[model samples]
Target: MAFTFQINNELQFNHDEELLKKAEECCPEIKKETKKALHLVKLIQDQTQLDGIGTSILEKDIDQLSDYHLKRDDSLILDFGNHYVGSFSVDLDQVGSPMDAPLYIRLKFAEMPCELNAESQDYDGWLSRSWIQEEFIHIDELPYTLKLPRRYSFRYVEIKVIDTSPKWQVVIKNPTLITETSADYSRLEPLSLEDKTLQKIYDVGLKTLADCMQDVFEDGPKRDRRLWLGDLRLQALANYSTFDQCELVKRCLYLFAGMTAENNKISANVFVKPKPLPDDTFLYEYSLFFISTLYDYNKAHPDLAFVKELYPIAKKQMDVTLKMFTEEGKFIPDEDYPVFVDWSNAFNKDTAGHAETIYVLKQFISLSHLVEDEDEHIYTKALNQLSNYAKEHLFNKEKHLFVTGENEYNIASQVWMVLAHVMDDETNKKIMNNTIEQLFPIKNIATPYMYHHIVEALFEAHLDKEAIALMKKYWGKMIELGADTFWEAFDPDRVSYSPYGSPIVNSYCHAWSCTPVYLIKKYILNSK
Candidate 1:
C-alpha cells in the first residue's frame, strides 16, 4: 500500500495509560503450527502465472534434501505448500572435506513466485528496501541450524550457496516454517456453497484474513504490519463473521484511542512493537473510521458498557470530521488529510468524501444515542444538512449519477452515496442502474478496498445479480491470476499495474481484500 507518507513532527499526541493498559489486557497469545517444505520448485517463465512467472515442482524428495549437496552457485527453492506468516529454519551440514571457507548463502523469500523473479535491486520505489524479504548470510561453522531471526510472510524460499569451497559442500535438510496467527480456524463451521468458485473465493479471503490476524489486525503481514483504523474496520467485520475474535478488535480500538492528536484526531495507523506509537500519517476517512469501527463492534458483540467506554473517542473522531463541512454541509477536504477513497488519484473524490461523511455521521449518531450524549441532537441535524446538500448539489438528477470535481462522474461517488443512503430506495436503485450502464467495466480503479464499496453499493441497491457478477469478475480474476490470498491493489484493466511502479511492494494478502468472508456470510448465506 503506497500511501501519502507525511510526518508532522509538530503534531502533539495524547497517550492514555488506562486505554493502553486495557489494550495490553486484551492482547492475544500468538498461535503457532510447524510446517515442512512440501516440495523443491523451479522458477520458470510462464504466461499463465501472475507477473509472467510460475513455479515448477522438482521431482527431488523433500525428505532427501541433504542428497543434493550444494557447492558454489548451486541453489534450490523450497515450496512451503501454502502462504504463512512466521519464521523459517533449515539444518545445514558439511558433506565434503574439511570446510575451507565460511559458507556464504543467500535466501530469498516470496509470497508468490513472481516476487522471486523480480530482482530486488531493480526495485527503487517509495517503499523502504529493508522490507524486502531477502537476506545474505555467512556461516562460519558447520552443522548449524540456519534459523532466520526475523519473521516472514511467504510461500516460497530460494536458497543459494554463494560460495562453498570445492573442499566441502553444504548439505541442507529439515526446512520448516513455524506458522503464526491469532485466528482460530477450528471455530469456523464448515460452509457448503453450491457454487464452487465462490467457495474458493471465500476460502482464499479467509486465509488472507487469518494470516493478517496477528496480535493486532495488520493491514498486510508482509508489509505495513500494524493496526490501521480503516483496515481494522473491515478486518473486524470479517472477523465477526468468521474468527469472531472480538477482543483483538477491542484491543486495536484502544490502541488507536490511547494515542491520538490533541485535536481528538486518530492516526491512520499505529505500530505496536517496542511501544504503541500512532503513525504521523493521517487520512480524512481513516480517522472517521474509528467511529464506524466502534459502531460495528457494538452491533456485532453488543456490550453497552464497552460501547459507553469507547463512545467518547468515537465522538471525538466525529467532531473532528464534522469541522470539514460548511454550515451548508459542503465538505471542503484538507490536502494534509486527504480522503483516500483508493490508491488512485485518477478520479476526483469531492462527492465521495461528502458521502463518506454522511456514512460515518449516521454511524456516529447511532453511537451517540447509546451513550446518551446531550450533543446527540446536534449530529441528527448535521446528518440532515449533509444529506440535503448531497441531494441538492452533489447528485446530478439528469445524469442519475453523483458528480465530483469538474463534473467528473465516477464509480466511487455513486458507491459511497448509495452506502450513505443519501436518497430513498428507489433513487438508490436508479443511481446504481445508471452507474452500471455507464461504468460496467471498471477501469483505472483498483484496490479491493474500493471494489468492496462498489460491490456493497450494488447489493444495497438490491442488484443482487450485478453484485455477485462484479464480485466474481473482480475478485475471481485475482484467484485466476494465482492469488493464494487477496491483493492490496488490482486493476482488471491493467492486471500487472502496481501503485509503487513495481509488483515487489504490492501486498498480495491484505486486510481490505478479505471482506468476502463477511460479504458471503452476510449476503449470500443470510439470503438463503
Candidate 2:
C-alpha cells in the first residue's frame, strides 16, 4: 500500500513475487541493485552512531534554540583521529536549557574506508574530508570535569581522538579554539539543519551522478550518446565546493577514456559507429567547455594525473573547433554532421545567427584556455572578432545596455552578451553591468544558461557578494517551491512545456534547472 504502480513510477520496490519475477526478466540487474541498495540503507541506519545522537537531540531541542542564531555548538563532539568536532549552543542572556553547564560528547566512526580518493566511487567518497556529518549520532554519558576558565564567557569542553588520515582540512569553528591545538577550527560554525540536510542531499546527487555516468560508460557511448551526458556529469561535479569532489569528475572522464586517444570523441561500446566524429560546431563547442573545466582542475591540483591524460583529448577537440574557422575569416556555426546544433530559444534575441554566433565564439575562447600548446594569437583573433561584432550590433550607448540581436532582446541574449564580455575582456565591461542591471529588475525570471552567464560574469568582475545575493534572491526562490532539483526556468506556477510542440515550454525535471541547485549548493553553502 505504501507504493502503488503510479506512486512508484520507477518500480524501485515491489514485494509482489510474481510481478518481481516478470520484471526480473526485463531488467534483472536493476531489480537486484534496487534490492541491494534497500538492504544497504537499512544496514547503514542500524550502524550509524549519529542516528543515536540525532534521536537525543529532538526536533524540540533544535526548535528551542532557533531564536538564538546559534552559529557554533561546542558541547557535542566527533572524534576523527586525535581531534574532535561537534555542535553546541550559546546562551547569550545566560537563560536557556543546559545553561552554564559543560556538555561532554563523543562519536565513534560509523562507516569504514574513512578516507576518499579521487578515482574511487564508493559511498565513502561523498564523505567530507575535513568536516563531514553522518546520519548517526552516539552521544556519550560522561560527566563534565573541566572547570570554566572564564565565568560568564564560555565553558570550554574538549573532545579528543586520534586521526589516522594523512591530511586534515576539516575544522571545528568554535569551542575547539579554547580546547584543542592539533587541527584548525577557524571556519567552524553550528550548521543549520536545513544546511546539514541539504548537504546530504547534494552528496546523494553526487553519488547519483557518479552511478549514472558509470552506467553510461558501461552501456557504451554508441547507445546513449554519452558525450552529452558526460559533459553534464562533469559540469555538475565542477559546481561542487570541495576540490576533491571536482577531481572525481576529472578522474571519471579519464577512466572512461581508459588510455584511449584522449582527443578522439568516443561513443559507448553500444554505439554503432562511435558517435561519427562530432562533425558539427556544437560538438566542438560543448566538448571545449568540458575540456576547459577539466583544465582548471588540473591547474589547481597538478597531482591529479588523470587531468594530464585528458590533455590530448582536450587538444584534439580544440583543433576540431578551431578548424571550423573559415578561410574567408568568419567562424561558421554550420557543421557537416551537426550532432548538437543549438539556437538560442528561451528568450527573444535580435537575430538567431547574430546572437548565436557570439555565444559560440565565447565558448571557443574558454576552450582556447584549456589547450596549453595553442597560440595566444589564435584565440585573441576570435575574441576580437566577437567583441567587434557585439560593439557594432548589440551595444546601446543611450540605454547603456546591450540590445538584442535582429529580434527583440530578452534574458537569453543578455546572458550571451554578459558571457562574451566575461570570456573576452575586449568588450566594454560597462555593457556587462548594464545588462545585469536590466535583468535584475525583472522578477520571477530565470534561465539556466542565462544564470550561468551572469554568475560567470559577476565572478570575473569580482562581484562575489552581488552574485551570491542574486543567486539567492531569484534562483533561491525557485529552489523553495518544490525544486526536488533545479529547473530550466522559474516555474512558480509549475508550467510544463515540450520543445518539439511548437515551443511548448513546460517542466518535467529538466537538466539545466538541476545545474542551478548544484551551483547554489556549491557556492553559497560551500558544502563539501
Candidate 3:
C-alpha cells in the first residue's frame, strides 16, 4: 500500500495499565543540549538543492540579530548549521517606538532551506497541514521570551513579521533550540572504516537513529510522531548495533505487548501521548516483525526471562498471521490486514508477503528455541510447507526470478525471496544477478526500508561488490544532495519525489532511512 494517511477510528483496543506502567518505567530521561543560531541567511535559487532553492549568507552577523528590528512583512532566516529535534525559544522586544499593538510574528522551522521558500497555503497534499512547522503568534507585551510548546525537527528557522504595528518593529534576540533525544553519545562505540563515503553514510545513519530516539522510537519526529512496528524493528536493530540501548528496546516491546487488538494482533503503530493507544491500522508484515524484533533483541542481549515473559505475545501475533495462510501454504492477503512490502502498490505483494512470512517464521523458530517451547516443530512444519510452495509455484527457474500475482517478476519479490533463503546460496546469487540485470536502477520504490532489504539481500547473496555499489549510489546521492540525515522518501531517478505529494511534509531524518548503521556494523565491520 502507498504511504499515506490511514485512519480506522472504529477499531477497539485494550490498554493494560500494568504493562503501560512498565513502558513508563523504561522511558529514558531525554538528554537536552542548548544550541545557538550560527548565521543569518536568505533563500536563493540553486538547482542542486531540493525545490531548486538554497541559502545565501547575509552580510549581518548573528551577534547583530537584535540590531535590525523587523517591521511588517520583514523576515530573515536563522541557520543553525545542523539538523536538530527540539523546542525553540527566542527573546522579543519593540524598537523605534513604544509598544503600540501586539507584535504579530510568524516563525517557520525547516529542516532544509526549501521548506522556508514553500508557502504553507500552497500545500494541497492529503497529509494534515497541521504538520507544517509554521506558527503565528501575537505578543501583547514587550520583552517577551517566546518559547514554542510543540517540539520541532529542523535546521533552519525562518522568522517573519506578519504584522508589528506601523509605529514599531519587533526586535529578535537569542534564538535558541533546546535539542532533545534519548541517545547517550558517550556510550557510542567509535568506528574506523577506511572508506570515507561508507563512514559518512554510517555517521548520518547513527544521527538519524539518535534523533528518532525519544520516549519511544518514533517513525519520524516531524509529522507522524509515533511508534510504528515496522520502524521499531529497524530502529531496534540500529540501536543494538550502535548505542546498544537494550532497555529502550525492552520498553518498546512491552508497550506493544501491553496493548493489542482484541484479536491479539499488534497495531502497525502506537501513540504514547494523551494515553497509550494502539492505532487501528494493521499491517501483516509489521505485526510479524514483532517476532523478528524480539528475536534480534534476545540474540543481541540473550535474556531468557524477558523473552519468556513476552514470548506468548509474540507467538499470538504469529498465530494470528498464520491463520491468514491458505491450505496450500500461500499467504492470502486480507483487506483488513494488508501486507506492506513496499510503499508502491503497483506490484502484487502476495509473493513478497509469502517470503516475509518465511523470514519471520525462521526468526520466531529461533526464539522458540530460546524459550524451550515444545511447539517449535509446528513452526518448522509451516516453514517447510511455505518454502516448498514458494519453490514449486512462485519460483521461475528459467527466468531465475520469483513471480508474484499475475505472474509478474518484480524486484521486491526477488529481494524478499533471497532474504528468506528459500533457495540454495548459489541459486540465490543467480536470482539476484538476474534481478540486477533486470532491475538495476530501481524505479517507483521510494522507501529506504525497501532499499535496505534490497541491499541486505545482495549481502545475503554474496554480491558484496554490487551491494556496496548500490549503497554508495543510492545513499551517496543523498549526501551529494546536501542531506544532513537521510530522508523518509527518496527516488534517485526523481530528485523531488514525495509519497506525500509535497516535499514540505516529508521527514528529512526518518527512522527507516537509518539502516546503514546496522548494515555496516553487522555485514561489513563485524564480518571482518
Candidate 4:
C-alpha cells in the first residue's frame, strides 16, 4: 500500500509500508561492521533530507544538567538547523515488570541515521526479565538518531556516555508505575479454607522440593529445559489422594513418556549445559536413568498409551549409560581424567573417587533390575562390585555413616548412603533410621530441602503417615508467604531470601522441587 498517514495525528505525510520496510532492513545492515554486531540488525537513513523539514530550527541547551543527572521529564529540543526535530518526550514508564524501577530510557527517533553509546560510568541495570532494565526499543528508519535527550526515570541515572556525533535525536520513555490491585491467584477457582490449606501445604512442600533437586535441574544444557520431567513425575506422586491426582499423574506420565526411549535409556540430565572447570561430569546421564525407572512403574501400571510411547527413549539412554561403564567393571566418569562431578554429573571417578561413584552406581544398579524385563545379571554384578568397593574404601563402620574421607563430612553423604541401599531393604532401613536420628536434633527440621531428603527416605520405607505430617507442617509455613510458584530453598518462615548467595542461581519457577508433590501423591496416598 502506498504510504498515507498523519504524523502526530496532524502533520500529513505519505506512508509506504513497503518502502519503509525495505529501507529499514537495508539501513541497519550498512552500520553493522561484523557478524556479531549484526545481531541487533539496525538500519539508518537520512529522512530529514527527504521529508524537507529544512527549516525546523529549535535547539534549547539548559546547561543546568550535570553528568548522569538527566531528569525523567527533561526534553532536549534538537534544531535540525531547520524545522524542530519532531518534539519527542521521555516515556520511561513504558516497560512492564516489577523489577524495572528507578530509571530507563526510551527514544522516539526522527527518521535519521543515528548511533548512541552511553558513557562508561553510566549505571547499567541488571538485565533479567524480572527486576531491572526492561525497556522495549523501537526504531523506524535509518540515520534515525533518537529525537530527545536520554532522559532517565532515575534521579541519578548516571550516563557517563562520551558519544558526541553532532548530537542527533533520542527520546527517553517515562517510567509507568504499576499497581497490582487484585490478590494473588485471584483468577483461579476458589478453594474452600480446607482445600486452600492443602494448596498452601503443596506450595510450601514444592519450594523445599525445588531446593532439594536444585543441582539436578539447573546445571544442564540450554536445550535441556525439560529437567522437570522427574519433578512432573513427583507432582503426580504428590497429589495421589486429591481428585486431580489422577489427571496430574496422567500428564506427568505423558511428559515422562516423552522423556523416555523405546529401548528404555533415560537421558540422565534434562538440562546439561557444559562448562569449563576441574570436573567434566555427565551428571544428567544417570539421574535421568534413575528417574526413568520410577516413570516406568507409572507407565506400566496405568497403560497410558502416551507413557508406553515414552519407553524407547528411556531404553536408549539406559543402554548408552551402561555402555559408559567399562568391561573391567569401572564406571569411567567420562573420556576425561581427573574428573569431578557437580550437580548434573553426580559421579566422578577422580574427585568423588570410589565412594561417590559407588553411590551413583547403586542408583543405576537398582534401577537396572527394577526396569529390566529379563535377566538382571548386569545390574547385580555392578551392585556387588560397588558394594565391595564401598566396604573397602567408603564405609566408616564405627560411625555407621559413609565419610567423604576428610571433606567436611555432612548429611549429603548420609542421604546418598540410604539411596545406595535402594536395592537392599535391610541396608536401606539401617541408613534411614540412623540418618533420621542424627538429623532430628538439628534446629529447624522444617528446612524444606533437607526435609525433602528425609521425606524421600521415609517414603521409600513406606512411612507415609510420618512423611505426610512433616510435609503438612512445612507446607503450612510456605503458604502464609504467598508463593505463586516455588523457591530454591524451603523458607519455613516464608521469608524473602535470595538463593544467589548460595550455589543456586535459578530462583522462581523451578523444576526439581516439583517432586514433593509427586512424593506426597503416589507413595503417601497411593493415588494411582
Quote each prediction's TM-score.
Answer: 0.98, 0.45, 0.98, 0.46
Question: Which candidate leads the pack in lDDT?
Answer: 1
lDDT of 3 by residue, 403-476 (tens): 99897889999999999999999999999999999977798798899999999999999998899889999888
- Compared with the true structure, model 3 gives a TM-score of 0.98
Off by over 4 Å in 4: 1-133, 137-199, 203-287, 290-301, 304-316, 319-375, 391-393, 405-408, 420-430, 436-451, 461-482, 489-506, 522-528
Worst 10 residues of 4 by lDDT: 29-38
Reference-based lDDT, each prediction: 0.90, 0.35, 0.89, 0.36
Model 4, residue 357: C-alpha shift (Å):
8.4
lDDT value for model 4 = 0.36
Please list the residue runs of candidate 3 whose C-alpha ends up more than 4 Å from where it truly belongs after superposition: 1-10
lDDT: the better of candidates 2 and 4 = 4
TM-score between candidate 1 and the true structure = 0.98
- Per lDDT, what order, best first? 1, 3, 4, 2
lDDT of 3 at 161: 90
lDDT of 4 by residue, 391-443 (tens): 55556666665556343334555554564453366666665566567644333
Q: For model 2, what is the alpha-carbon lDDT of residue 339? A: 24
- For model 2, where is the 10-residue window of minimal lDDT? 31-40
Q: What is the lDDT for 236 in model 1?
A: 96
Across residues 252-365, which tens digit of lDDT does each residue of candidate 1 receive? 999998999998999999999999998888998999999899999999989999889888888888888888889999998888888899988888888999999999999989
Give the per-residue lDDT digits (tens) of candidate 2, residues 272-335: 1332122112233344455545545555455445554555555555556556555433445443
Report residue 250 deviation for candidate 2 (angstroms).
3.5
Which candidate's TM-score is highest?
A: 1
